[model samples]
Target: KISNEITQFTFPFDNDVWSIPVHRDNSYYESTYKKSPMSKTDTINTPATFETKDKLFVAIHEAALTDFASMTLLKAKGNQYKSDLVPWRDGVKVYAQTPFNTPWRTIIVGTKPGDLVTSTLMLNLNEPSKIEDTSWIEPSKYIGIWWGMHLETFTWGQGPKHGATTANTKRYIDFAAEHGLDGVLVEGWNVGWDGDWTADGSSFSFTKPYSDFDLDEITSYAKKKNVRLIGHHETAGAAKHYESQLEEAFKLYNSKGVNAVKTGYVNKYLDKKEWHDGQYGVRHYRKVVETAAKYKIMIDNHEPVKGTGLQRTYPNLMTQEGARGQEYNAWSNDGGNTPEYLNTILFTRMLAGPLDYTPGNFGFDYKLPQGAKVQTTLAAQLALYVVLFSPLQMASDLPENYVGKPEFKFIKEVPCIWADTKPLDSKIGGYNTIARKDWNSENWYLGAITNDEARD
Candidate 1:
């Protein structure tokens, strides 16, 4: 499994340990496992393939240069990287195409006030076998929304959406299709969400929906409207039952034309070691990949596992929310992420795969009408369509919120998967730039960001 084409970076210090800042606001976009494509701008050069370690190293260096340059320009204008102020930003986050544990690790160093530090990172995947040359699906043409309109049907914090009538669900689906959406997600559609957490965990029934929601009718109607009905499975609480019932679930979903599903492992339960299958977040995730492949159904996992280039092995494994996502709205007031963290994550958490960070909640900014639920600005959300990579991307914000906003074009233009990806710059938690091109089209998509204070 020795890849002569892999890059290697030797630090001057011992044990390859280094610290970098991770801004909390950047956490707004949780890393998902989806990807979109962009036309090649030819703005930067890329290596066709890393044929040797030297080439890989060269690629990283080149990417680092580009990232630094972009951030440097931004910093000159007075934008300071926020991650430098945080203590936890200095840690190793791996995103490899194969399962690779870097032989090296580092202790992060805090940046001086008003300063930006760039850290180099190594990219490797544990399973090179998973890498695929074929495009899983065209990037950008198709867009999706996650967890469906359930939150609209019922308030997230107000307990169950018992009042989520079938009429309400249809109305939401109709909106997506009317507005040219490709798919809609429906989380919390099972019995567990409504007080049957125990028995329902093992009793996974793809054919069934909560008493109030008519899944079959909804999916059928969605198809007629040319919109997809994305199914969901919350399994961390009931792994054993889910494993046993998986085939049936897939078969039922297949029968119903459910091409996509969002699986989740939310809570950390005791004595349920098998739920994670005695593997770290990444290893257990491989099992899901294998299972989904058999059924030919695409999957988007949340709160359960981390990704490391498995999309190449299983194209259907669309996206995963490995990092803090919009769900932060329900939890804390930390605001979740910042520009510094956004720039750093690309080099660390997303180096190996597509992120389903569920971008696009335009309603959160403090500047919006008083009492609005959104937390960030419309421009930032627009940036995510470029910054976050995913084949199964989500327009997580409510349809009503986007009603007359023309900025929605950014989402319309973002590609979900790419034919090839080139890391233009690599600075683990400082600044990073990625250039990905659609396999079919000459067009390319480029995303670059930096930690606090920018780089040069």
Candidate 2:
């Protein structure tokens, strides 16, 4: 280890791929599908953490200037793996002035998985809430026009089958209102859905809705039903485009009483220059949270940087999608994620913060055209509402699939925010159960899930 920390360096090469050596740590977990929405290559492009075999995941979290990302990086250093902070990604250099205290290097430990599951080390490390008037930052359950696009039952692009049309959005709003859900999310209402938007989102528009969808009318109607219109801003990979329209977009939503938004960074950033969680990516995400705060908007960011307990500083940053989410069950390599997948991540990636795993899917028996299927049982689907922690949760299935099903009641009744969490029997990849006290009511909810084996 070096005695002096160098604030400036004289590397002759460009800042392409660089990381600062933080201290060294032993223990590496065997992870095949570390990144979520599991595909053949989500890892080569996604940020990863140090997963160890000791039934615990340890990481360094930034206390301030969170725009810098830290990692328990896994590199073949001689015979053992060491720790590092992925400071520079591709083009950006992490050069800061001196007198800067390094982020907190933390090691979260537990005898049983429960100890790791319920530990508040991440939240305890972060500063207190920056949003004083946090009444508007609601913990909600929403129904969205999302699964259809993934399921190939509907289209994100404008067409006869466009999922975000005015009619389709109204249908969801009505469903949410009738079911007592707090919000409705309608994606693909904007102008960027056509022709390779994810490859380069320079043409995406945040403020403008497609001609078939009515943002003002939809927002107004949702208000009448006492439901909020959860907004979406998918940048594909064009950060600058989204930044340019950030204020204009926030202004429109604010005027219409849209208090929450789900952002996407499904990017091919700057000819694949910046990483989604690099220093540049970190700064952009932080700006979104700060800017969203001014307009009293809560955010659920996807393809996001790992949560560093920043929600304490910006309560408006509600939750994040950084794990292999439910979508992997519908389409992934090896004919869908293994049954052990969910339990595995619950101990590892979930240690960071609240995750939007979008758990309540009733279509446990459906198969895609290519023969992939959801690996969870119906009971497990219900159990996820209690296990996964997301302030802005989603009942991630079509309304038709949910109606009249007896088990759907659990999704409706589950609480989004919790006052307390109690872990029960658990193994990292076998089975897990947890009970949580509701943030509002005195009601307590318990959720348990297992691997493919039937639990007695």
Candidate closest to the true structure, highest TM-score = 2
- TM-score per candidate, in order? 0.65, 0.86
lDDT of 1 by residue, 160-278 (tens): 54433456657767877777777777665665554445333554454556676777787788789887777778764565666667787878887777777888765543124322211
Q: Over all chains combined, what TM-score does candidate 1 have?
A: 0.65
Q: Model 2, range 277-374, lDDT digits (tens) per residue?
A: 55677788889999999999999988777777889899999999876677766666556656677776676667668889887878766767666677
Give the distance in Å from residue 199's predicted Cα in candidate 1 to where it truly belongs.
12
Candidate 2 least-lDDT 10 residues? 18-27
